[model samples]
Target: MGELVDRVDEQDRVRGVVDRGEAITHHWLHRVATTVCRDGEGRILVHRRAADMSRFPGQYNFLVGGAAEVGESYEEAAARELTEEIGVRVPVRFAFKFLCRGEISPYWLGVHDAVVRTDITPDPDEIAWHAWVTEDELREMARRPTFVADSLYALDRYLSRGEAARADPLP
Candidate 1:
């Protein structure tokens, strides 16, 4: 068995447990948690996926996170991912979630936001390169083909919501 995740229905309700790989291979909906880190000035952190990653290698995204564990709530998973991926431990607020038709798989993406008041220590296994860019710069990044489509979708939704900070309206 691979990493266990809670398989979910279209309504985002827990259905059963499944291997992460199997869920992706079969297009089963599972929970993914991502945190968009912003500095005090609101510049967003964008990063390139590691070249050695099994998925989306060298691709770009405005967030950093991963699949939620079997019983982890979206917020817990987002906080956990922020620590694991970038070594930043801060309180993350629920921004929103949407069903993203990913380039490689389909999953319910729970997007969160964090203000990085301290330094970051990125995991080389997950992030290759990172930089903070203004929202206008991030808006330009959204047009790149090398970027993760699902991430762009998240970014688009996040920006469209008016306030950078908001709670998830989905159940």
Candidate 2:
């Protein structure tokens, strides 16, 4: 089993759900990733999803992330993915949440921000290309079909907040 999330109603009441396939098909799983990068620069790191990926192959994304493993919280998964995908231990502060429903996959994406001081070591199986881009550059890139919708939404939310240029350390 990959992982499962508790679907909730308007009042946040559990609706009883535990199927990844259904979650993807119906938009339910609460997955997370770290949109990590160098401190105070506000430059976002983008990655190219490997061509072998089951979903969104050869797509460009900013969050170094993955599905929340069973028994793992969103922050834990974000931290693990930051380390796993980029070789960085980032201080993951809550950034935003997204409910993405499309023909490809429906995933509840939890976006987290992390600042670090190290070079990245992307996993070849997961990432094909990588870059550190400015907000405007990312916005331009999002216009392309290769960018995932959920990630683009998340970046839009993050950039819309105007925190991308701040110098304060992530809490």
User: Candidate 1's residue-wise lDDT over 42-96, tens digit each?
Assistant: 7889999999899989989898899999999999999999999999889888888
Compared with the true structure, what per-residue lDDT tens digits does model 2 show for residues 18-117? Answer: 6666666775644544554644576778889999988789998877887765556668888888888877776887666666554566556667777765
Candidate 2 segments exceeding 4 Å error: 3-19, 26-29, 34-40, 164-166
User: Any idea what lDDT model 1 has?
Assistant: 0.89
Q: How well does candidate 1 match the true structure, expressed as C-alpha RMSD?
A: 3.3
Position 33, candidate 2: lDDT: 48
What is the clash count of model 2?
0
**Per-model CA lDDT versus the true structure:** 0.89, 0.70
Per-residue lDDT, model 2, residue 16, is 69
- Residue pairs in collision within model 2: none
Prediction 2 TM-score vs. true: 0.81
- Model 1 TM-score? 0.94
Tell me the lDDT of model 1 at 70. 99
